[model samples]
Target: MSHSPAPRRRIPAPRPADGFMLLLEAARDLRTVGAVAPSGKALARALTEPVRAQAGQPLDILEAGAGTGAVTRTLIPQLAPGSRLDVAEANPRFAHRLSELVRAHPHLAGRPPEQVRVHDVHVERLETGRRYDVIVSGLPFTNFSPHHVEAIMDRYLELLRPGGTLTYFAYRGTGRARALLASPAQAHRHRAVERLLAAYRDRCATGRRTAWANLPPATVWQLRRPAYAVEHSGTRAATAEGAGGAGGVPGPAGVPRTGL
Candidate 1:
């Protein structure tokens, strides 16, 4: 009997934490002189829950200012079998580290390099031809100037296809918007988010702030682009119905989470 040729050797899956050291090094080189980092656990929650709420639909996601893959790590497991994600980061060091992290994850193994795209450019500088179904951001909103904040907000809002969701979190304690306003640099960031959201309040399907139990007590802001005939209300409502009180506005629970 002829002996069969030796089987080809299979490569081991990548380690999820290989880039941990690199991520820390990159963090040290960021432009943020003293920005407070969001708690990893809270950041993870902010990334995962939105996918669950969307029922793990195969869709496009845009993440801004992804530092060291904290949020991406949490989001990967929550994605549908073939979901695609794009990260837009201003810090080159952090961006490079993020790219390395994806390559090291077991779930990300065997995928084409293009499966994960990273843009090492300012969020404001990105001009992607494609729109996204969801946009997750950890930008330093509380530290930007009003103009900068407005610009970023308007740009992202324009990028969102109708009915898309934009999820973000703001610090509440020492790093909170209210507290940050005491300093000029951080104050700009706070005002920008306020102005931008106020300008587009009516077009959101779910606009609520969640007070996190995590350290620094941050607040999470989540908004979804509205379908036809939907409008932004001035006040914060617990659910869509609350915002549309007496008029049968849809609630967050019933709104089908799908890409526009």
Candidate 2:
């Protein structure tokens, strides 16, 4: 009689340290890091739903504020052949880790080196000439000032191609919490940001979903750029102010204007 050997269980790559890193970064700057823990699996899934919806087609994706690459891990596996991903992380440490992850991702091993690129720069400052088909944002809009939020949102629209989708998440109860526990100035700022975002939502939002499984429940909002090119004077005013009069919605020269 012959004895059969047991099958070995595969061990996942080490990721236990991401939580600690997130905490450290949050402590250093809560405005940028926002949450103390990395995003949960459910949240990542909700934020990447647009990409999954466009499965089987090559897509260009941009992931902003990719702290610890939690969502990046989710985005990479779903990339179709010939697709490209550009990850932007403002934090140097997080950007370094993201670069390493992009390099080591198994799914990208056989793909061209340019298939994935990690940029250590703020998403607003990122100046890639190419537009994206999907933009997944992990930035904490609630933590930022109204001006910054408007600037970032404008930049996202500028980076997206017409008919492109943008997905982002906001933690639940944050507005209420700020109203109760934050200073008057903070609360006012939050309210201003809310109003600004509400305008964008009214103009472009397609759908929204809640991810209850996340550490702090979050609502993911999906906005689609209009398929046709049209101009909006209100958007032009907001974009000009957000860009500090540096001309409207700066991008690669000759990029067609897709007014929000």
Candidate 3:
């Protein structure tokens, strides 16, 4: 007796990272519930490619304003073994949740406890004198003023390690209805974002190239000191000393000093 051929078996499809669009929905809802600005997941996704290209080996990432660790959640699994992570969040409640998430996940558990510091302090305050090999941020620069933008930029300049990279993004396109819904103060906020981007152009190691594939489209800024530059401390010292002296010529107008 011949047995009938077994019915064709269907292979299960692969699931997207964090359940795909559902993950995006959850991230969107988190921002909505908090009445915060748009989450930069699209930008964060766009950054992954560049980060992989630049980092080569496993990356030691410092993520600011991780929210529910949406971006962090996506990024950590992609990293290689022995890579470290340090996260700083301004919201205590969210920070606590992030801590819990790290504990709950196996991939995240590999990182050291000391690496994650969930403080309720702003980036500028938390980053002073601390340095990171790679910094990923989701802070809403569009909510800040021009001076506040400059202040944040100064912090980035100091806190990013030589040969390190920094990645952050903002939403640039909005419909008329969305614009009308935005507060009257948004115009100034927009200017703040523009100025911050201008600084990125002037300072970032990656220059002005942008990633066009993201949902809202975003610019990526990557900065790194040259190998020779990193090895030569004497030249940097001379510039530092000259800039510090009372008689030295001034830098660009409104560039701000370490404390200003």
State each model's CA lDDT, in order. 0.60, 0.83, 0.54
Question: After superposition, which runs of candidate 1 have C-alpha atoms over 4 Å from their true positions?
Answer: 1-34, 174-211, 228-260
Q: How do the candidates rank by TM-score, highest first? A: 2, 1, 3
Per-residue CA lDDT of model 1 for 1-260, tens digit only, reads 99999655342323354355444544674334224343456655864566778865787788887866667777765656567788897777678877777766666666666666888987778877877788888776644544455457656766777777888776665435456445543444444445444544444536555546555565676777655433323232221212212212223332322322
Better of 2 and 3 by lDDT: 2
Per-model TM-score, in order, reads 0.68, 0.86, 0.63
For residue 121, model 2's alpha carbon misses the true position, in angstroms, by 0.5
Per-residue lDDT over 1-260 for candidate 2, one digit per residue giving the tens place of the 0 to 100 score: 99899644332353889999999999999978998999999999999999999998999999999999889999989989989999999999999998888877878766899999999999989988999999999999988876677688878888899899999999999999998998877776676677667767777899999999999999999988778765544433333223212223322221223544
Question: Candidate 3 on 146-217: residue-level lDDT in tens?
Answer: 455556765765566666667766554532434677554554345444654564445444743455755556
lDDT value for model 2:
0.83
- Error (Å) of candidate 2 at residue 152 is 0.8
Residue 258 lDDT in candidate 1: 31
Instruction: Give candidate 1's whole-model lDDT.
Output: 0.60
RMSD of each candidate relative to the true structure:
9.6, 5.8, 10.4
Candidate that scores best on lDDT: 2
How far out, in Å, is residue 24 in model 3? 16
